[model samples]
Target: MRRKHLLNTFAAAALRIFMLLTLGVMMTLETKADISEEYPDFYTGAEGTNTKGINFVQSITVLAPEYCSSVMGDFTVVFKAPGMKYIKAFCWRQPTDKNPGKWGHDAVLADMELKEGEMGKFVVKGDEFPNGPMTIRIHAKDDKNKQDICELQLYNLGGVKWNQGIPDRDPPGAAGMARVFADDFDGPLSISPDGMNARYAAHKTGGGDFSGWQFSDPHGENQPFAQRDTFLRIHASKPLGTQGRSGILSSLRPDGTGVAVSIPSYFECRFVAQSAPGTWPAFWTLTKNTIGMDKNDPTFEKISKMGSDELDIVEAYGGYGHKNPNSGGVYSSVSHFWGQPKPDWNQRKLADGSENTDFKPSSFRTDTLQLGGKSSWSWTFHTYGLAITETDTIYYFDDIEIGRHPTGEVSKALPAWFLINYSIGGISGWQIDMERYGNKTDMWVDFVRVYSGCVQAPEVSASGFPGAKPAVVTMSASTRGAEIRYTLDGSEPSEKSTLYTSPVSVSQPCTIKVRGFGKNLKPSPVTEYILTTPPGVQGSIGINFVTDMADSEQALAPGDVTGIAPYIQGNWNNVLAGTKTTSRFSTSDGATSPVTLNIEGEAKPEKGEPWGFSGNDRRLKRGNLVSNPRFTLAGIPYAKYDVVVILGAGIHNVQGEIHLAEAESGNHIDAFSFDYGWNGGQHAIATTKPGEAAKNTNYIVFRNVTQKDITITMKWGSGKGWTGVAAIQIVPQKD
Candidate 1:
């Protein structure tokens, strides 16, 4: 991978250091005794460093419904606590992780009149909570407000079977997508030598994360990771007092190669954690830039052309003190953009440097979501998910979308590998109190899964317009391994429809509907096209710039004037100049025009797979600063026609000028500048939602131009710019 620029790293690091250094001061102003008020024994920041002599309550022990027991129906909590005025019980439904401070109860307590002498029994129903791990808190307090709280850890198997492991249900908004990867941890997570067959690695390749202080491999004969009973447990502990050791499982292997999900993809993890003080647990993904890579590696070349990015699906910091409240019940979804142009939303700063503006760091952004209602993630296995499309990145908790942002440019450009880890207090200012839990904690992962974006809709094209002669129509799908199905009568195409193996001939005007299907994938959205001969002169041409030499070259199509629509490639940063092409452009009148096109100066071709677009629609030629590429179209039959120029750079945005002129006379026809805007870069395609037709101000029109040949020149806009042209069309204007 390309060596990360140190200037960007130091600039972002300086901001983080500033936050760390000022956290204490911020805490002083924002910290309140959110938990200490209920439990006087709960430690808060010391003011005098002296102990209070108040009377304290003794310990209580649960006698029935043992720890880790799976409860399905009604159950009684029988505990023992003598010399107490009254005892009360309530289910604090532990957060996905356990902490020492007081916790809130989700299930109501019963039989409040019961006394401790009678062995306190409070009836409760196991069905009151969702199926997952839970915690039952027993409280006993004296008149002096000093209280002793005890908790019982167990699982509630009310709605789900005990041995079923992680649920196999698909997440929301996953329609039409296909599962690309899945692991339930039913077997051991062993490391393979080359990381070819192994599903995981102990750490990221080449030694990154926590600076060697955490996620150590084989800590003194005790591996920090243990997989069994359909769950992968990551144990965190302070083995040497000052050093925090734990384990991490990455999709990347030791050789820096492993499973990665590309955009238009979804990744998710279902897990429970111990949200105790000082514990940090997370489910996240990073690009190859995070792993150690050699310049000669095959993938390194592709990665070198892109920037780095990180997607933190969930970051749960465990603590109940004033600085960290709600613990695992609340988590953050963060994204980092490294060594790339920052998105527009991340460009804000205090103009005068005198005011504190609500702005994220220049390199990162974060948003938090809470489970709410006294429920914490550590209390049970909750699914944390991330969906990445070309335009946006969405975060989901338990299948519910929590936050969304414009997809990072780097994220859209590169594939991402995932990681899960349990860390012991390092950077998350929340103080560690693991001594109460034996200086160790665990984060349980039930499963990790990945899904590719939906199969793109089938694109239909014709060799000639339907009229006096037969027109040969062809169809294609962008999703690999997908099968095209179609219908001639405009009916919805199903698996029972005619399977498309080759081009089909249409004798007359008719409607054709098509869809694509693949194994383990949701069916592609259905598309319908009407083929007919029109009086207006009509034709279109798409230019393909080679990025991957292995890609099959797409040929020029007749391109219907009635708008034949379907689907979506990005090339690297290099520019190609002086490319030429000559082709016969088919028209609606059943005649062909010999068109010769040539580009002068620098130009770039986009060939990467863009979501929701395919074939020639996915291709575009772009021009940049210093060289405005000019395309000369010769041999066009003399006629007064309206010329339409399609804009957009596939996944990238373009802001520049499109100038039309007579090729032979050198007389300018028209010229104007345009901007595709941020995030929503490709204006002609719906990169946010698959299969939806997105059309707006994505085309420029030069009306009633009388010319046998024309020249189109693309120049970068004044400020931030690149000029992208995907396709061009010519239609005769009515006299």
Candidate 2:
């Protein structure tokens, strides 16, 4: 029994060894198969009826054969496991060098257990891997003992490619590239938002986007020179299709006064290219009829019946360095003329020695000119511009002029509306690689401008008075070649109005109308003004006083009262005094003079009383006799009269009255007087009345009627002695 049992144990151990060896062989075979092929073969589980195992393991890895120049879409890894009791899959980013080994770097593990004897697949998308050369490790583990690993290589592939070649045929041709129709106008183009200094409108497809175009007018004063002067400016966001050229258009009309259009010698249009992997944008002008140039010559003739002129401004190629490089650095410029070129032909040079060359066209090319030596033109932004004038033509890129044309008088009048566009490759020599540049390249048009003739003012007129000269009438044009027309009839002036040769002369009141007209028949608004001269004046008046009297006493004393009084008397009687009863005194002579006295009078002197000279003396009393006794001299001559009164006696309480006669009519004059009192030194008085009659005697009477016994003497005319008189005379008026 013991021997039998031992043998049984030995057999069992032998079976175990055989089983382990078989398993190792199967694993070896599986590994070899996976290593020999790009994809791994699936392993069956331990169930013979289902040769599957409880735990199965499978793995996969991807290796990039070589670095891909370009990559598109996503990279993927796929695998399937069949006949496994259950399976779990794991994927990890691995280096090509470490394929089919433990994924040491960052990795994602799928450790899900599956049902017995089930089939499963594992897939990993490309983005999961790194950019450079890489590998993907895919591992599948099932319920069975089998484990498998597979490695796949990854590569880089770039974007799609495309090409736009030149046009195979030509479109119909209109007159010259640029033509100014006779119907064009020279007046200000009426812009909607009236006062706007400068503005531009563009026509584009696909909902226009102008972000790519940059605009700048450093000097804010001047308007951008557009159709009237030269061309428009455009820039591209990507390589433009060269299949068709771009177009820039303009229109002109008479403002109001008349109908005429003035043209410049030359004009310009400009464009820029997108600096991308592959892109080339070109600018060109074409007749309105041959937009695509699909129609033949006969078709162009039919279109020409509609009146249109076309011109190509510039064109460029983004690829080929024949002129520019594959990287994009080439440009070209050309101008088309309508009929015969003008006398001072070349528009590039002005008579003033200034360059008329357009800076827009050559600006972009010169910017990348330095890159021309390189194999590929470095992708970068570019700018271009073109300017044309009656006497000159200029072309520029980014403010840099690349070309110029000296042909003067390109057009006698401004050209009709023309078209401007940017094309990738078209009739012009432009061939661009669309693939390198992407699907679409953007072309931006900043604006189009026209600068033509200046507006002129009208004539002015003056009227009413003689020798009235018309105000200087000044006029100016927006550009040039504008003539001023004016009339003095107050009527609106037209083109037929008389031309203003010089300032108008006005001797009488009149209204003037003025207007400005261009050589092309375009007219400006009429300006009008009314003028009147002033009238004249007549005869005058003059008067003067000649006197020998310098001193105040002499100037105020009466001529008849010659002497001064020394003593006080009981009844002081002089030619200046009058009796209380009569109340009047007459002067010895017809002349009159003024006098001063110290006395009292119950009744003041009457007209011509106490008078000594040519004028009457009328005494004017103040209040009642009880109050202060005050009197004024009256009836003085129409001329200046001087008077002086003197007191020679002791202090006396008395009332004094002095009077003068009025002068005759037509007498316009003035008077003055001076007085001297008894202890009180001197004083003065004067008088004059308009239209008063002159008289012989003017007197001043004094009556000693005070309660106290007062004694005083009076004097006039130098006031030396009691020459006595109530009045005096000194003058006959002089002029």
RMSD of each: 21.9, 42.7
lDDT of each: 0.57, 0.30
What does the lDDT read for residue 263 in candidate 2? 38
Clashes of 1: 19
The 10-residue segment of model 2 with minimum total lDDT is 537-546
Residue 271 CA error for candidate 1 (Å)? 1.5
| Residue-wise C-alpha lDDT for candidate 2, range 186-215, written one tens digit per residue | 233322111111122222211121212211
* Candidate 1 lDDT tens digits, 1-735: 111222222222222221121122121212232334544543323331211221233346677876445677888877777665445554543333343222333444642433546677777777655455566655564333233445455666663334236565677745457765678888857542123334566655545565223766532223677665677767666655456678777777544445665677888988877655566778888875635465776877777767788788887765543333322244667787766776656656444654445443322222221233334565556678898888778888767777777788777766678888776665554556655445656677888887777555666777666654577898977566889999988899999999999999998788999988888766766767787664344343333334433322222234412222321111111113234554564455555557677677566654332223322333232221123667887876646776666654433344556788899898987775565444332344212221222223355667788888899887664444343565556665555
Candidate 2 TM-score over all chains jointly: 0.25
Return the lDDT, model 1, position 326.
Answer: 26
Candidate 1, which segments miss by more than 4 Å at Cα? 1-88, 92-105, 109-132, 138-151, 155-169, 187-197, 211-213, 216-220, 237-245, 290-294, 297-307, 322-328, 339-341, 350-374, 454-735
